[model samples]
Target: MLVIGIGFFYLRPIIPFLQSQRAEATTVNKVKAIETLQNSDEFSKKLAAAALKRTAEDVEYDPGYYDIAYPGGDLPANKGVSTDLIVRSYRALGVDLQQLVHEDMSEHFRLYPQLWERKGPDRNIDHRRVPNLQRYFSRFGKVLNNSHSLDDYDIGDVVTWSLPYGAAEQAGSHIGIIVPGPGARSGEKWVVHNIGSGPKWEDKLFDYEIAGHFRFGPIRESMTAAADTKSGATLSN
Candidate 1:
């Protein structure tokens, strides 16, 4: 009788906590589309839009890894400064992306790989092998899947991926964010991810590259103060 009573006492408090966590996982709330961009301090919004534009919509399949090219005829930076682009954009947004600490972006992935266990129709990533994926997922709220639904995902929305890396492209590694466009059919939802690199969201995941995707919406301007991100030399988004 004592053992049973003790077990009940120990678990009583935990049941409520576990229930709360589950509740948090299932909830889905997406931010508005262009409104998110327009409100996200012009610079951050411009950078988010630019990262998507900088993707493959360019000169046509150059067939090279890390091919250096600028978007919309914009001149390319001397070095591939992807991180710089993100931070500068944050500065423009009146927030510092660098200020986002690990805690700010770490605990979002509660269940981690479990979110997208199998290689669903996407055929992109394993969802588990993605870099720092657990951190991002656990730190943020419930992640959004790839399927399009304007009310479900929006601009400045962040996504993470467990990508396939290494020479033969057989290895698994990579993580990034997603930027949404007008509508689901508007065809402008792009990604802001990094595979074996710093914080820069890429436009597309081509070749045999497959990684986890986290549909993280941009929070209010005041949230950046919680981000304890690391600083680095100037880089491009």
Candidate 2:
């Protein structure tokens, strides 16, 4: 009885530590299981690759309005907000979200949020707004359930979050793209976003209140073909 009591006393101190380690291992295993289940489709892979490339560029967190050209407009490469990351990524895939959003809003102006209170759609800045992008994705992309489960988010998925109440209106919302994690987080996923800083790939998937989740990838060949036909230029493969 004395020997057993001594052993229990020594083990009690490390019991919590062992439990935590076990829990962490379980989580990692779950992440790996979900990773294996990921579709790994060509479009998603391309989108993830494109977003990952953004991490290499030095972008300033600038949200100033500028009158860029239509059809394939973009803010200066060095300055952009979170939405710009999404814009640039999809643009890499030959998907002109600016044009698509502008055209859709033009015909269905009432369908979108009038938060900015503009008379009509402003192609110059509409696509750069988070709310506008959320609406666009919900309309055209597959809207996934917003949950705390890491399993729900997959590579190339787009996520949006509502910032805390005191944040500036322009900074009230944020967005990011999911991509494969780096190094130790390989079993998990990371988010690529430009929140106040330049583009980054970090393990911040659940850092904020998830407001929207979407899978908008695997661009249909017809869509790419139509874009090519309209622009009179072949999209990058």
Candidate 3:
């Protein structure tokens, strides 16, 4: 004769373990997320999806007027807007942006290496201060300098500026865009980023040594290692 025994599980007992497992799973996901980001094309759709999810992690726009603490008690505001969420979200998906940030620091002209270190609306991180960083940041604010509209943009794009001469010290040009590339404009693709206002943005840029431009994709072959770390499947032979 053969017999079999059945067992039942109580969620409470397994809940803690399940949560722990979920956290681990998220960590793994983040690892994968970072690799994906490091290797994919600048305008890759996959990267966009990963960044969007990351942006949603923080409930508040910490940099904005919204002021409410995140439920987890780690971040400051509830629904604030900070690139940290984008980075953390990548963590949830098993990714860490730091890997790329540290490896290819030169690729980014106006990199804010310590943007994550500061808090409480403090933008005093002395990043590599590119010549025209401010002009770039101004494009996304409530008052974009020459913007018509920002209806099409993603994440991981860059923007440059051409500030007035002589004032380059205090009122010089600036550029930055940890966001994404915008849609096609005048038959050419545009980029999206926050110069000072809403995240819902889009704009036009040129491919040159001057005003502004958007860039997304791997800069160095060494950094591409992140793509293979996933070990699940390879893409783009």
TM of each candidate vs. truth: 0.38, 0.75, 0.31
Per-residue lDDT tens digits of candidate 1, residues 119-226?
231111222133333344445545555543435545554443334444211244334445653333234555554333433333353332333334333456655542
- By lDDT: ranked, best first: 2, 1, 3
- Show model 3 residue runs off by greater than 4 Å: 1-43, 49-95, 103-157, 162-188, 204-237
Q: What's model 3's TM-score?
A: 0.31
Taken over the whole model, the C-alpha lDDT of each candidate is: 0.38, 0.77, 0.36
Model 2 agreement with the true structure over 137-183: per-residue lDDT tens digits: 99999999999888888888999988887352365799999876653
lDDT of 3 by residue, 108-196 (tens): 43443233344222222121234223322332222222333344433444445555663332234444343332211122233332223
The alpha-carbon deviation from the true structure for residue 79 of candidate 1, after best TM-score superposition, in angstroms, is: 4.5
Off by over 4 Å in 2: 1-41, 166-171, 218-237
**Shift of residue 233 alpha carbon in model 1, Å:** 4.0
Cα error, residue 152 of model 3, in Å, equals 17
Which model scores highest in lDDT? 2
How far residue 29's Cα lies from its native spot in candidate 3, in Å, is 28
* Candidate 3 global lDDT: 0.36
